[model samples]
Target: AIEHDYHDDAPYYMLLAWFKRVPRSSDKVMLLTHGLMNINRWDLAQELQSIKDDKRSEQGTFSKD
Candidate 1:
């Protein structure tokens, strides 16, 4: 499970549930993009870049302004 606090007073959660899943050894990727008007951070960009560089993964999130 992955959790992000978003550094806000009101807490929010995004839950991903999978049932009867099959694993594969391929470069299948899912990207999530979020728009933020009040927040700005480049850390997410670096994280995503690192993941892509590794070339072995699935499922990720990238939040941006």
Candidate 2:
């Protein structure tokens, strides 16, 4: 799970972008962490966006669904 500050407005997509680049973690863990981050941000749209981005990345594209 992620520790978050609701007052912070840093773009959620940025975190997902970085998550995809880390070399040592499993996809499941990355997704789980992303989930927690979005939950903490109270941004369902960002959560969905992250999942779509992950799928696109797995398919060799980094665009939207």
Candidate 3:
């Protein structure tokens, strides 16, 4: 589905394409992480997880002001 929708081979581009198709009500990060892991792309999954954690941390820092 991701490949058919997004014809790019790059992980970043592929992720962007896949994300666009995901429903707004869903836990997109978790879904994306699982998808990456399902394809044995644990490294990408970890990277996505870290990015999500960093974003949350930044949001928390800003909200404390």
Candidate 4:
């Protein structure tokens, strides 16, 4: 299984995309969770906006390179 920081707020669709990108033989499963007090952070409703923007910029640079 795979685990993330939990504060990253990555959604199911994002997780699924990552999963699909994995090789079929990887046999990996991703588990996302947060502490009771931190559950809201996992929602990613706000924190991810900046991350998404940054990722787009990074991808653009990589493509240009």
Instruction: Give the number of the best model, judged by lDDT.
Output: 3
Comparing 1 with 4 on TM-score, the higher-scoring candidate is 4
- Candidate 1, residues 1-65: lDDT per residue as tens digits? 12233544223323222211324553223322122212443465456556666654433223321
1-65 per-residue lDDT for model 4 (tens digits): 23565446566667788768878876332222223125666555344555666878999999998
What C-alpha lDDT does candidate 1 achieve relative to the native structure?
Answer: 0.37
RMSD of 2: 9.3
What lDDT tens digits, residue by residue, belong to model 3 across residues 1-65? 89765555576786688878989899998998998899999999999999999999999999999
Please list the C-alpha lDDT of all candidates, in the order they appear: 0.37, 0.63, 0.89, 0.57
Worst 10 residues of 2 by lDDT: 1-10
Superposed Cα deviation of residue 36, candidate 1 (Å): 7.7
Predictions ranked by lDDT, top down?
3, 2, 4, 1
TM-score of model 1 relative to the true fold? Answer: 0.28
User: Which model, 1 or 2, shows the larger TM-score?
Assistant: 2
Q: Candidate 4 clashing pairs? A: none
Using lDDT as the measure, name the better of candidate 2 and candidate 3.
Answer: 3
